[model samples]
Target: MNILIAGATGKTGARLTRQLDEAGHHPVAMVRESSDTSVLPHGVETRQADLTDLADDVCEGADVVVFAAGSGGDTSEEMTDKVDRDGAKALIDRAKAKGVSRFVMLSSIGAGDPDPESDLAHYLEAKHAADEHLKASGLDYVIVRPVALTEEDGQRDMTIGDGVDPEGKAHRGDVAAVLARAVDDDLLLNRVVELESR
Candidate 1:
């Protein structure tokens, strides 16, 4: 299967690309710039791309597209809305237009709850809004909502089941790996699932 990863420069994105290669899958990574991902599996394909305005024909071609894009911590709420929420929405729309079969999204866990008073709340609100959009979109989609993220280097230690609530922190590596698998055959038809460490 050919998998396209947006925001492939992120913490989980890089590791996920490697795992995809190990599983004998084609990994197409999209990034704004180049980086050490050069050492990624020889099978991995990297492209200079921005997900903000995705083209339906381009996005629809992927067997699966994982949206791991995000605005960094230094960004403001307004930026979060543009990058995280709006950017995500654009990707979904394009994927649907392209007739893509699967879409895996990385959304923050707290996004489900509504709280816009705090600074960080703005980002969560935006994420939540994006989540809603994806849910309503007519595409096969899986939205992984993780809690506070940690840069722990390890495989996924948690097995999140149905009704699982992403209310706590999980390693970015873990999240990435799970999202990749979801895009693969085992969970191919699964619609949506949230993940977090216990």
Candidate 2:
């Protein structure tokens, strides 16, 4: 499988890129011109593309498209909308046009139903819109909604579904495992699963 991963240089995205490669899939790390590709797995293919302004060929030749990009917590709400909302929608559109098999979205837990009173309301709102866009894009999609992310190593002992702890922390590596599995796992096809480190 030729998996094109957006934000492949980020914490969780890096893990996903390596895992997919180790699993014998071709993982293409989609990055910006300034992104540091040194963090990616050795010999992993890379495609230069900016999320805020993606070209029509950004998703070309990809079997699957994984969107893991974000504007970061320190960025403003406008930036959040640019990268998380509009950017994801644009990527989804490209993937559909390119005939990608599946679209995997890395979304936060609260994105399913954002609360305006929450401190992360802006970020969640952006993710909510993006997730919705993907769902309505008429593509085979998997939305992995993970709770607060932690830097811990992947335990691989995950509790997935509504039974997962809403307030619990998810190891970044474990989340990567789920995203990688969604690439070819029919069980996760077109399903939105919540993830928690158990």
Winning model by lDDT: 2
| Native-referenced Cα lDDT, model 1 | 0.76
| lDDT (C-alpha) at residue 183 in model 2 | 90
lDDT of 2 by residue, 1-198 (tens): 999999999999999999999999999999898999999999999999999989999989999999988899899889999999999999999999999989999999999999999999999999999999999999999999999999986679999997888899999999999999999999999999999998
- What lDDT tens digits, residue by residue, belong to model 1 across residues 63-117? 8888887888898777888889998888888778777788888887667786767
* Clash pairs detected, candidate 1: 60-98
Ten contiguous residues with the weakest lDDT in model 1 = 184-193
RMSD each, Å: 2.5, 0.6
